[model samples]
Target: MRVLAFLDGTLADPDAAHIRVDDLGLMRGDGVFETILVTDGRPRELGPHLDRLARSAKMLDLPEPDRAAWERAVRAVLDNWSGGAELALKLVLTRGIDGDPEQRPTGFALGMEIGAAVLRGRAEGVAAITLDRGIDPGLAERAPWLLLGAKSLSYGINMAAIREAVRRGADDVVFTASDGSVLEGPTSTVILLRGRTILTPPEHIGILPGTTQAGVFRGAEKAGFATKVEPLRVDDLLTGDGLFLASSVRKLTRVRSLDGTALPAATEAHAELSAAYEAEYA
Candidate 1:
């Protein structure tokens, strides 16, 4: 069952929740959103998710999100949640009707089930194909209009890449930039394990800052694992001791293969990593 609530704190039926047709979020895909993982009725890294939501809004020139109102909306949904081990809590803020800046932005929180396919990926892992993202990574600094680093609602390309991956007989996608740097998975952050070090591309390379990945790095550090943020090349993805994709909803899923090539399974290290992930953080 899905539960939804508005910024004003009214709980509603998710299936029936509606927004005005002229809302720019619907008209032009103009808005920002954050998907948070709810485990055992608790939101993981909620502060980070909200922080990112605000950052995205700033990038899109939307009104600053009212944090307390969103928090109240989230609480209402969780209070109404049906018992479950996992949920996807999405908080959305839109450029409201007619795209008027003077109007209150449209906002809501939705709590829903995490799909079985997604859970299966976390357990059995995924097979992915590499796709060229078709942009110079460095260009993002010069092409601010592209909104490459913001988690805005303009995700047609990301979804299309995943569809292309499936057509190529893969379960997911890893996008490479014009410079041939392995950027990230369409919906998740890529992390590589080498010895005791866990590495990921820095956010400065024109990707959204990953909240769940930051959480994992903290966990890894406390468990004696080192962490670094560096650009990853496609070759590096193939040579890592272990490859993982992290997201709020998926938590951490191993990448069993890439472009039809099997990667090393750092079993013991991965187990320890999983253990650390389960320990979670405050």
Candidate 2:
């Protein structure tokens, strides 16, 4: 536990703050959350992230979050933070106090952390491992009632997978289905490129619809490249000309190797597109 919590309309450390035993969020992970990059005191893509979080909360049958209150809470945290050229802000809204899993609480908890950003800017890119995890085909396209697209706190499995990848000498892990089709990274979106055309798995395939991915497509199109979304296979990736992982924090990281085999790093065209998107956001 770290000292990063905004509880009950005040700034307090999580370890020092007291929560009710009936808090369903703590008991059953009954909550929705969003992590945004707060640069120069402004949270990027705040609107879309909050919209997704609200959708996720509704899917879980949790009480609707107070949008204005949540926004104010984040602003309060930012206002108190002293320094950090760049910071990460996390907004979590869970059913605050409830014993029965069948009942929703009237309030939610908001937490945030101010820390150094994970830097990933080098021509020598990161290595990755692909995990063959199975995702239900139905949940791939339409958001499921249970598998809400909102960010949940139950991320033990994802953290374990990342640890496994790091133990294997990879900086990150790319998740694949049992059928060998590509999905996404543990926290980023996957993209494959051939020549100048940019390709990524459709979000309908149970992949997280990434904000950075959309920015990449827009930048690529502006730079005169054909951007498309399609189902990608392992062979397609191995044979593809280049590979990249897109995210708000990481920006764009080239996948230099995959499953012990080398992948063509993002070429000049890819770098140009990435820089364009970064410039737009910066």
Candidate 3:
């Protein structure tokens, strides 16, 4: 696959890379970024994705990205990509190298086009184990200086949780607070179905406020499902009709099991919700 990297103001092949290590993002993981799926050479929800990226950057105290420049770079990468179907574009803006490690560094934008391999397409929806620390409701309302819902480069803990789930023979991990209130997945958003209502955790619960998940809910409401963002518990899944993990790439994958227990088969509501979500991006 041919890949292009836009570093600072120059766009070139990654192998011709001259990325500097002094950049905090290169050495210390100090930056914010966004990944988007591209279909038929057009980005899905381009405006919304850029909005989220800007919000995350502001939360991190980083300079806002140039939205127009980013879009042009994305289009350029796609133009060079021979395989245009179901591709992915990543917009990564990092704090550039500082003259001194103790000083704050200016930021630079990087764009890359890569192929996506979606395991969820062929595999059954994932089952997950709950985390002990449920996300605090208060944190979602007020941004903490460091954890203000920013898509920071520091995601070691999140990745570790997902690895733990894989070790237990599950596809992913679902985090909940000690109180048993569901939070979200390692890299995807959680959505549950109960009868006619579609449930997602409120953003005020410190959830990532997933882009794809929100899109799915919007499509669901249009398709006649009563969608809501509310607190959900692990017990809800054990007793609910079905559950799903939503993401830009994964789109929607039904959860067939939870904590080793098999979820009830998909109902009419689940089918309708899934169809609505899939059809929107299809």
Candidate 4:
């Protein structure tokens, strides 16, 4: 793994304790981030990831990210990476150290080979538990301060939820709104398949727009699968023809079970959709 920090347009070692203790992102979790997949030395869906990062920064009132600087840092780390496996490239932007007169933002890029656990989950499928997110689906529209759509650095709750799920003997979690509408996974997007139609929860429901899901839908359309956005419920997964959690690094992973109930097998669809997604980067 290698990390390169972009400080005022210059790149430096991330692990050398370069960030100040007063950095808002480190102190108050005031920041935004994106995780991109690098395959064969090329970042997949770089445009969408950067677009989302900009949107998140705007939502958080942080300075506009320097896309070119981030790109250079990504290239620097990837060029020096010697691993033959796929890599995960993370881009981070944080509000500058608190009380600083200049009020700048800290930005950096980190590159690491994809973990074996993530790869195994994608191959073996995953069992998930439904966790209540404790918010209504429409809350984001009414309360913008919640920052639901922004991929902010404040992920402590999300991480805790996943940890709790694992403690309960599940591999992951599918978060549902208070009204029982499926929102998304803690770190991935939820997608359902009924016949040849591919369905996902509407983005307006305070869920992060999934870059991998967008790519999957595009490829699905070409592969004769109708794509749709709809409100989904737990019953949808228990009875649907197939279910998956999609993301940039994890790619397309099937949901083998939900709440300990075995889901219908859709391995062929999963394989097709997974290949379709990979084709976008190819």
Candidate 2 C-alpha lDDT tens digits along 1-282:
122545345666656646676676788787767777667877777777777777777767777777787776677676766656566667776776765556645343333344223464334577888887667445644557546244676666678888999899887788887677888887788888888798998876676678778878887888788888988888988998898888766667788888999987567866787777766667
Worst 10 residues of 4 by lDDT: 2-11
- Per-residue lDDT value at 178 in model 3: 61
Worst lDDT run of 10 residues, candidate 2, spans 108-117
**Which pairs of residues clash in candidate 2, taking residues 3 or more apart in a chain or in different chains?**
140-206
lDDT of 4 by residue, 1-282 (tens): 665646334556656888889899999999999999988888888989999999999999888887787777777777776776688998989988899888888888878778887999988999999999999999999999999989999999899999999899999999999999999998999999999999999989999999999999999998889999999999998999999999998998999999999998798898888888777767
In model 1, the runs with Cα more than 4 Å from the true position are 99-101
Go through the candidates in order and give each one's C-alpha lDDT.
0.89, 0.72, 0.72, 0.89
RMSD for each of the candidates: 1.3, 3.3, 2.9, 1.3
**TM-score of every candidate relative to the true structure:** 0.97, 0.85, 0.88, 0.96
The TM-score of candidate 4 is 0.96
| Backbone clashes, each candidate | 0, 1, 4, 0
List the candidate 4 regions with Cα displacement exceeding 4 Å: 7-11
Give the Å error, residue 133, model 4: 0.2
Local lDDT at 130 for model 4: 97
| Whole-model alpha-carbon lDDT for candidate 1 | 0.89
Candidate 1: pairs in clash = none
Residue 88 displacement in candidate 3 (angstroms): 1.9
Give the 10-residue window scoring lowest on summed lDDT in candidate 1. 273-282
Q: Please give, for residues 236-275, the per-residue lDDT of candidate 1 as tens digits.
A: 9998899999999888899999999998877788788877
